[model samples]
Target: MEESNFTEKDISTVETSILSSVEASTVIIISVTWFDTRLQSIQWFGEMIMLIFITGLSIGENKVADKGKC
Candidate 1:
C-alpha cells in the first residue's frame, strides 16, 4: 500500500478548520433566524447551505482521519 504523508499536525489543522467553519455557520444560522423572521426563504436557504457544508466537512474529516489511521 502507498504510504500517506499526512502528519498529526496536518490532521489537527484540518480538524480545527472544519470545527471553526461549523461553529461560524451555526452562529450565522442562529443570527439569521433570530433577528430576521421575515426572511423565511433566506433563512431556509442559509440552513440548507449550512447543512450541506457541514456534511461535506464531515465527509472530508472522515477521509482525513482514515488516512491518519493508515
Candidate 2:
C-alpha cells in the first residue's frame, strides 16, 4: 500500500478551491431564490444581498493576503 502526505502548498490549493466553490454556489442559490416566488419579500431580498456583500469582501480579503504573501 502507498501513503501520501499533504504539503502546505496542497492545503492552500484545497482551501482556495473550496472558497471559490462556495462563492459560486452562493451566487447560484441567490439567483434561483431571486426568481422564486416563495422568496418574494423585501426582508429576504436584503438578507441575500447582505450575504453576497459579505462573501465578496471575504474573498477580496483572501486575495489581498495572498498578494502580501507573494
Candidate 3:
C-alpha cells in the first residue's frame, strides 16, 4: 500500500468543510427548534455545545495554519 501526503491546502480545505458542516447543522437545528417549541431547550443546549466544540477546533486549526503546518 502507498501512503498519501496531505499539504497545508488540504488541511485548510478539511477545516473549512468541517466548519461549514457545523454551521449548517447548527442553523438547521435552531430553525427546527424554533418552529417546534417542545424541542427548543434541548436544541439550544445542543447548539451551544456544538458551537464550543467547533470554535475550539477552528482555533486549533488557525494555530496550525499560522505555524505553516496547516
Maximum-lDDT candidate: 1
Residue-pair clashes per candidate = 0, 0, 0
lDDT of 1 by residue, 1-70 (tens): 9989976644566567678777877777677688863547877687678678778878998898899999
Evaluated at residue 49, the lDDT of candidate 3 is 78
Q: TM per model? A: 0.48, 0.44, 0.50
lDDT tens readout by residue for model 3, 1-70: 9777954544566577677868777667676677763556786687677778777888888788799954
Better of 1 and 2 by TM-score: 1
Question: How much RMSD separates candidate 3 from the native structure?
Answer: 7.0
Ranking by lDDT: 1, 3, 2
Candidate 1 segments whose C-alpha is farther than 4 A from its true place: 1-36
What TM-score would you give candidate 1 relative to the actual structure? 0.48
Candidate 2 is scored at a TM of 0.44
Q: Highest TM-score: which candidate?
A: 3
